[model samples]
Target chain A: MLLKTTLIRLLTTAVTLFGVAVVVFVLVRVAPGNPIAMMLPPGATEADIAALEALYGFDKSLPEQFVIWLGGVLQGDFGTSITLRRPVDELVLSRLPATLELSIMALVIAVALGTAIAVIGARRRGTATEVGLDLSSGAVLSVPDFLWGLVFVLLFGVLWPVLSISGRIDPQIEVDFTSNFYTFEGLLRGRLDVVQSTLSHMLMPALALALPLAAMIAQLLKQNLKEVLLQDYTTLARVRGFSETSVILREALRNALLPTLTLVGVQFTFLIGGTVIVERIFSYEGLGNMAIDAVINRDLPLIQGIVLLFAALFIVINLLVDLSYTLLNPRLRHG
Target chain B: MTGSQTHPNTLDVMQLNIALPNGHRLLRDVSLSLRPGEVRVLVGESGAGKSMIGKAVLGILPQNLKVTEGEILLEGQHLNAMTPWTRRKTVAQSAALIPQDPLTALNPARRIGPQITDPLVRIHGWSRTKARETALALLDRVHIRDPKRVMESYPHELSGGMRQRVLIAAAFAPSPRLIVADEPTTALDVTVQKQILRLIRELQQETATAVLFVTHDMGVVAKVSQQVTVLFAGKVMEDAPTERIFTDPRHPYTRALIAATPSYADLDRPFSPVPQALIAELQDDIVRDDARHQGGAR
Candidate 1:
């Protein structure tokens, strides 16, 4: 049975990724602007456009072009970008690490900050502290994430200048692209300055993305933890002389957090969605910025590659969250 | 030590008055006492304040309810007068509770071994190995044939009777002087309930730990308890030795409760519910008492 379910998940992921690729390819072809117009300078002749089209094989019929593109994708070649003049795979690969770093950092912030507030509110339920946290989290949850991105940029970039808001690193420093992830590459090469610079640049964008997600997580945790606190096991913990901390953290939190995992999984989808505008606002060179540039220039190959990759990332994250259900609940695990 | 002939009253509850947040007095001047190895059953229908007595003793009462006037003395220690932390410490060392809903009473995420032996490790400062051994011994005492497998299994992996037995073992881990078993078998099947009750009674007799078994089932009270208290609308309608209460119940409420109880021997006998007139009178007294308390506060 387990093997059957495992095979089903793998099959579904592959099918869905193929569907996303087809959708992206169709949308790009149907859109108004041709890639050749955007490829050449403004006053270039029609001959120049035709030559470029022939070079990229876009002059072929749409079906033939699709088959050629599909063949390249099947063979692990994402093709070259019409706008950037580099391999689509290389461009996405360079930006993939940055996007992952930003999302991971934001998610860490969200879970940590949200859990601390949730614990405080749950412990002192009905008190002013709980009420205040609830009100504040509700307010933050209501605001759009892009506005948070703007607010954070103004506060950190203009007012305090506490950290750098944009780009992966200071341009002046000669940096090696060992892993494309500056922090990982820096640590690998024993360069503290590079790691520091990469992290400082990451802090704002990650925070901008995390604040709304954190507020969302806190609200769910508070509500669910309140109910779990009243469960018989919680009372049993107290009756057995376990400390209040032990009761809440070990017993109550596991039961309470079970319900909130669904909300956390949903919030992750929103976090991935919010990355486009957030990366643009902070001038961070992640997949979000790459996607926008591809769209503007009608770079079909680059757009197709990035969208498929995003779909794959999204599916993988959902799979992870689903697997985590077994960990958080023993009944599900044993079954 | 289990058979030591100490004074009869191991736990003393005197003049306990608990009120709701709305100033609705629930338990008015309630009191009871227990002797070592004795079982006192608090019997009442739902919402009759039967479990409230158990909650007050454990200090695990709901936040909305407060014990305004009461003293719960365990082995001459004043549980009511102590600070919350101190009361918790004193209670943990000398008392325990076996809760309702056997399925939910044990944490599902935990193995049966750590959960049963946690008090020994945390409160008694026993080593992990010692706790495991004690836990295994406890499983044997509870008639769980395969001690090693039961120890490693989660609560959901066991039957209802098995889970209740695990909880019963945990309750007696510290050899508590008093155990508040608040309808510990209410959620189980009839046969499982009988087995759980028998196990609890056998363990209580063996360890000489007093048990305040809360239940509405007379069959259960008859099987497990030495004495019984019949509560009706927050009042103790009858208190007597178990057999005597069964044979010569004096209160009208007690008579109604027994008549209302369904018996297997007599299927044609009509099960009569408590009369509305009596319930009205009890509710009226509560309203009057609530007004009086409000007036006194003013």
Candidate 2:
């Protein structure tokens, strides 16, 4: 039954992704400037524009172009980028690491900070401490991610100069992928200085990205934990001599985790969208930057590939969230 | 009420009064004494504070509602004097509460075994394996068929009766000195109610645990209680042995309550008239008493 349900969910996700792909494809196409026109220089000849259109298959009928694009997409051919003159897949892959790293770090920070604040707020419910935390988190949440990024940039990058301004690493550092600076593999090699440098560079951008998500998650978790605290089982746990912390953490928090998991899944997807602003602010070479460049240069293949990648990421995250629901709640699993 | 001399086998409540924050007394200066191995039923109307008495004994009252001039002594030790942590441990080890809503009384998300074994682990420091064994044994004792399966099931998976039985097993897990069951079988069917009541009675007899059973049903009072305390709007209007209270109730409210109770012989007849005016008067008195107590405490 679990396997069947999971399969159904996966199939639904695939259908949803297909719908997203269609919408992205049409929306990107309907937007103002033609890619061939954008690619041409000022006062270019009609022959030059025509040759570029034919080369990029823009001269074909819309439906035919869509069919050819879709077919190539199914067979893993995402076409070539007009701006970079490289395969769209290669560009997406190269940029994916930085975004992925930043997102994972931000999610970690969000989960940790959000859960701590929520748990503290819930435990100190109706107190000034709780109220203060709640208000601050709410304030943080109301501000947009871009504004938060700018604020952090001003505070840390400009005002204090505690951290460097741009990129995943300092341009002066000549670190190999084999070393422990750029990748997870490198961090495991006991190279603390490289790891420290990488973290220091990533910290501000990650915090900027995570702050809003953390505040939102804290609000979500606080509500859930408060509700869980009122459950009879919590009372029973108390009467059974379980300490306040143990009851709250082990019983109430565990039960409350389902809703928080759903929120985390949503936040993760939003993180992908928010990455555009974060990457821009930090000058990080990620998919969001690639997508922006593609949009500016009117590179259709790059845009399509980035959109598809994002849709796929969203679908996978959503699937994982659904599966986690069953894992957290045994009743759902058995039922 | 005169204090009963402390004995090895009695749970005693002296001058127990529970006042709600709204200046309404749910349990007045009500007092009762139950011998170990004895079942004492507190019979009252829906809002007569019978459940409040149970909560007070368990020291699990809702936030901000003071005990207000009360002493709960279990075998001569003051329950209210102990630190909350110590009190909770003592309660878990020597006292258990079968809350009114059995379906909700157990944790919905947790399996039955761990919930039942929680006290064993927390109070007795039993290993998980030993606790599980004890839980299974207790489930069997409660006559739960397929104890292992029931142990593995969550509260929502079980029927109302099954959940009630699971709660009963959990309550009785610690071999408590006292058990305060607040409407233990109120949510179950008539047959299941009888079975649950029977299980409580059997457990009480075997464990020599004093049971302060709270219920609105006089029939349940007759079935389980040896002594009965009749409360109307929080005050103990009538207190007597169960047979005496049933046969010849002293208080007008007690008589009216008994009259209102549907009997098997009166299947064709409607319920007897309840004097709402008299109940209202008693409730007013309870409120007035509550105000006076609050003022006195201040």
Candidate 3:
């Protein structure tokens, strides 16, 4: 049963991704702008425009152009970026590490703090502490992440000025990065200084992005935990002489976490997509930051590449969530 | 330690009153005692506070309800007088609950082995190996066909009867002096309920554990309990030896309950529910009693 579901999920993911690629391709073209016009200087002639369009296969019909792009994409080519004159796949891949690092950091922060606060709130349910948590989390959730990023910049960047507010890392920290994943490569090389710089720069933007997501997680998880705590098993655990902490942690938490995981998975996909504005705010050169540049410059291939990567990421994360659901829930596993 | 000459009752609940925050009493002046090796059933219809009594004794009552006036003694220890932590520790060391709704009474994510052994190891300070062995023995004793496999299995893998049996094994594993079997068989099929009741009875007798069995089924009470406490709206309608409860019930509510129970042997007997008039009269009497009690307090 597990194998069958996984095979079906894989097939659906392929179909969904193909649908996304086609939509993105058609939609980007349909928008009122010619990539070649946007690329050339204001004084360029019609001949120059026609030559550029023909060179990039833009002169052909939409279906013919789609076939050409699709055939190139099948063989690891995502076309050349009209703006940077670089391969779109190369540009997206180069920027991927920064986004992944930031997203993973934000998610870790969100899960840890969110789960901790939720546990505290659930344990002290109906007390003043729980009310305070509800109100504070509500307040946190009311604001969008980009606003949080600006506030973070004001508080930690302009005011206190203890941590780095802009960029992936300090240019002064000279370390040989073996791969684009600077933090991982630095850690592997035992160069803590490079890793430290990467983290210090990541902290503010990541937290800004994480705070709202954390609040969302806390609210959903706390509510789930409250309900689970009232289950007969939790009461039975108490009757068995288990401590309140044990009852909550051991019995209630596992039951509560399943629904929270679903929420986290969906929210995580959005969080990655949300990084577009947040990355710009921190001047962090992640895919989302590059995505904005691609849009402004009408870098069609780059935009298509980044959007497709994000779509693939969304599908993969959702698939992972489904797989973990089966793994975590014994009922699903056995059934 | 008096060589069994004079053993203290396993559990003692005196004038236990559980009330909601709005001063609505859920259990009114309830009292009972259970000697070691005794199985006393608290019999009542739904909302009659039968299960509430069991929860009260085990210190697992709902947070919305408070034990306003009560004292519970477990093996002569004054549970009400102790500090909260101490009370919890004392209760944990001696008491267990076999809960209603077997489906929801075991954590679904956990394997049965850890679920059963955790209390033994944590509360009783037994080693993992010893607890595992004891759990295995108890599971086999409950006639679980494959104890080893069931131990590794999650609660969802087991049938309702199987889960209830697993719970019974867990409850008895620690050899707790007091076990509150709160409708353990209520969620099972009819045939399964009988087997579960028999298993509980066998285990209770073998371990000499005092069981406070809560049920609305008169048949279960008759089959399992030596003494019966019949409750109606938190008030005790009758308390007597099981023989007298069956043969010569004094309260009108008790007679109505007995008459309401359908008997397979006498299929011709008309099933009569507790009369509405009697319920109204009982409610009126309870209101007067509550008013008097409040007035006296003032």
C-alpha lDDT values of all predictions: 0.86, 0.83, 0.90
User: Once superposed on the true structure, which residue ranges of model 1 sit more than 4 Å away at CA?
Assistant: A172-174, A188-190, B1-8, B272-298
The candidate maximizing TM-score is 3
Q: Tell me each candidate's TM-score.
A: 0.94, 0.93, 0.96
Worst ten in a row by lDDT for model 3 chain A = A173-182
Worst 10 residues of 1 chain A by lDDT: A170-179
Which digits, one per residue and each the tens of the lDDT, describe model 1 over residues B1-298? Answer: 1223356367888878888876577887778888777899999989889999998888899999998887888876788789888888888888999988888888888888888887788877889888888788888999988999998898889988888888888888878899999999899998788889889989999999899999989888889999898987777778899999889999878887887889999999877788988778767876786678678768
How many Å off is the CA of B257 in candidate 3? 2.6
Which has the higher DockQ value, candidate number 2 or candidate number 3? 3
True contacts kept of 1: 0.75
Q: Which ranking of candidates, highest TM-score first? A: 3, 1, 2
Residue-level lDDT of model 3, residues A1-335, one tens digit each, is 87897798889988997898899999999998778887789999999999998998899999998888989999999999988989999899999999999999999999999999999999899999999999999999999999999998999999999989899999998866757898999888898989999999999999988999999999999999999988888888888777787788888888899999999999999899889999999999899999999988888888899999999889888888988998889888655
lDDT of 3 by residue, B105-139 (tens): 88989999999999888888999999999999989
Residues A154-271 of candidate 2: C-alpha lDDT, one tens digit per residue? 9998889999768777776666674222656447766566667768887888888899999998998999999988877788777777777788887898788888998899889998
Comparing 1 with 3 on TM-score, the higher-scoring candidate is 3
Model 1 C-alpha lDDT versus the unseen true structure:
0.86
